[model samples]
Structure formats: structure tokens, C-alpha cells
Target: MSDIPLEHVHREPDSDTGNAVFVLHGRGADEQDLLPVADRLPGDRHIVSFRAPDRLRGGYTWYDLDLSGGGLESSQPDPDGFRRSLDMVAESIDAAVDAYDLDSDSLGLLGFSQGAITSLSLVLERPDTFAWVAAHHGYLAESHADRSPDGIEGKPVFVAAGAADQIIPASRSEAAAEGMREAGADVTFGTFEGGHGIGPDELEAVQAFVEEHD
Candidate 1:
């Protein structure tokens, strides 16, 4: 576990409901980046947006990526950094729950790109931590494939990817969906018509998915 403190933005619902959603930003983005999307979610839930721990350029990253080789095969994710971020996220969630008197059973997670990778990792590593998860334009890290054999049989998962995403190919997204299914999660996977970013249609689908499980 890491000793680093997590930076976050918390939005309380109008009615002060105990439910909460943890929103994670993509690479080069901060905690505030996903606040709008969290606001648009279909619920009276509290929103907590967390910042990545690692500083990269002017923004932040959950883990360092090594693309020294050629293709995705040569790319390497920093395992140590990833683990630290995971710990930080866990700590943040606990703190949020306590501070807001939130319902642990109603907790959900949403992430984009690098944030999505970390979110999925958290769900896989701690299957009972989240009620539902939405991973956008992300993949399961190769390093975490052998952690545990325990399956998330009843967990609900939504995965959205762009068919023309240049940064993360559709193949990676498909493989991620397959992996989640193999882990026994009830997975809802979809591919959009655009590039490496989220669109209105994708957000609508995610809203519906979350509502279904909420």
C-alpha cells in the first residue's frame, strides 16, 4: 500500500442521499475533468472524483507507460505505480464513505482510459468493493491477470470503446470484455463509431447501464 494522500473533488447530492459514485479521470486529466459526467448520472448519489497520483508533464497519470519497443507488445505498465494508485483509490473510497455517511452497498465506479484501467483493476482485485463499474476506452492490465481465481459472479460491468480508437485498439477492448466475462461478471460491452473519446451515445448507454444496476 502507498502512503501518498489522494486528491479529490466531492459533490454532494441535493437530498444528501448516502449513495456515491467514484469518478476517475483519464491520462493527462485531473479530478475535475469527470465532474460533469458524474453530475449527469441518473441518481441522487454523491460524486467523488479522484486525481491520479503520478505527475506527468502538466497533468497526471495512474502509472507510467514504457513504449520503448514498437507496438503494444513492447509497452509496459508500471506495476509498482499501479499498485500504489490502487491503494490510494481504496483509501479515498473509505474516507469518502465515512465522511459522507454513504451506503457502501450502493458504491459505484466510473473511469476513462487510464482511469478505466485502474478502475477495472480495483474491481477485479477487490470484487466486493463496487456494486457496478463503467470502464471507457480501457483494458485490463496484463500484470494483474493472475491475482485471484475468485470470480465476480454477480457484479455488473459496462465497457464502452471506440471502434476507431487509435490509442487503444478495439481488439484490446474486446479482449477486456472477454476477460471480465471469464471472471464471471455480467458484462455489457459496446463499441462507438468515433475515436479515442466518449460521445453522447456512449454516455447514454452508460447511464442506462448504471440505472439498471443502481
Candidate 2:
């Protein structure tokens, strides 16, 4: 894993509750860019936002992939990069749990775009590490799908996507949802009327899921 430093933003909801939501930002964005989204969520829910590990030409990147080929193919997701990011995030979760004396069963993750892909991968890679994962407009890497047959049997998952999205097409998102379902995760998938970015309806759905799971 790359030894990268991270910037974090946190919000503690209740002094007695240990439940927390770990938020991951989208591409070309930092922790500060997405922390404001927390304002729309429950004020009482503990929120933690983490910046990406790598600084690209203009922004940040969690992993590397080729987009010049017209269609995303033969691209590599930096395992070391994701490893570092996961370590940082995992440490943050542990600290939150300890600081709040939280029940291990109440920890959740919220990720958007590239963040969503990372969040979903982390939960799958370490099946028992999290209670739930909220994936917003991201799909699983195709390479990861057939590598293992094991699914997150007990973990709850919420996936929100835009039907008109051209960047990551709705078909791709649906396919990921199907894969998760076949893998035994309790999945909740929703599609909105927009494209690429999350809209009000999607946010509302995410808020409800977080509240119910958290």
C-alpha cells in the first residue's frame, strides 16, 4: 500500500452513540467538497469524510484506469492505492468506534462515484468489516465479479444510480446490482431520472437508508 496521508472531516452526532458514516468523495474532489453533503443528512449521525490518496494532474484519484481507449478496458485499479485508502478508512472507523463506544454492528459506509466503487469493494473484500455500504452511482470492477464466489451474506447494501447517466450507463449499474444479489447481499437498488450525478430524489433515498441502517 502507498504510504499516503489523508485529510479527514468528522461530525459527531451523539455522545453516547458510536454509529458512524464514512463518506468518500468523487473524482477531482477532496474531503471538503463532499463534507457539506453531510449537512443534508441526519445531524445526529457521526460523519467522517476522507480525501483520496493520490494527487492527479488537477485533482485526486483512488486508483488508475485507462479512459483514452474510448471504452473502459484493460484498466488497472491500483491495488496498493486502494489498500492505503482502505487502511486509512479502517483506522478512522476503529477510532470512531472507540471514541464513541459504538456497537460494532452500527458502522456504515457512504460513497459516491469512484468512492462508491471503493466502498463496495472494501465491504466485499472484508465481508464482516462493515454493517452496510451505500453506493451512489458506481459499479463494481468487472475483474472483481468472477474472482470469488463468496458474497456478503449478512451485510445490507443500498445502490442509487441515474438512469440517464452516460458516463457509467444504467446497464452497468444494474449488472452490478444483480451480481450483489447473486452474491447473497441484502440489496436495495434505485434509479432516478438524471445522469451521472446524484439528484434530490437519490439523496433522499440515501438519507432514508442511512437513517434506517445507522
lDDT tens string, model 2, 1-214? 1222356776767565666677888777787766666667763667778778778767687776655545652333556666667677677666656655666776678888778878877787766767789888788765467433354885688888888987777776777777777778888899999998878898888778767765
- Considering every candidate listed, which one attains the maximal TM-score? 1
TM-score of candidate 1 relative to the true fold: 0.93
- Model 2 misplaced regions, further than 4 Å: 1-5, 68-76, 99-102, 147-151
TM-score of each model, in listed order: 0.93, 0.83
Question: What's the number of clashes in each of the models?
Answer: 0, 0
Writing each residue's lDDT as its tens digit, candidate 1 over 91-173 gives: 88887788778899999999999988888889998888799999999988887655444658868999989989988887777
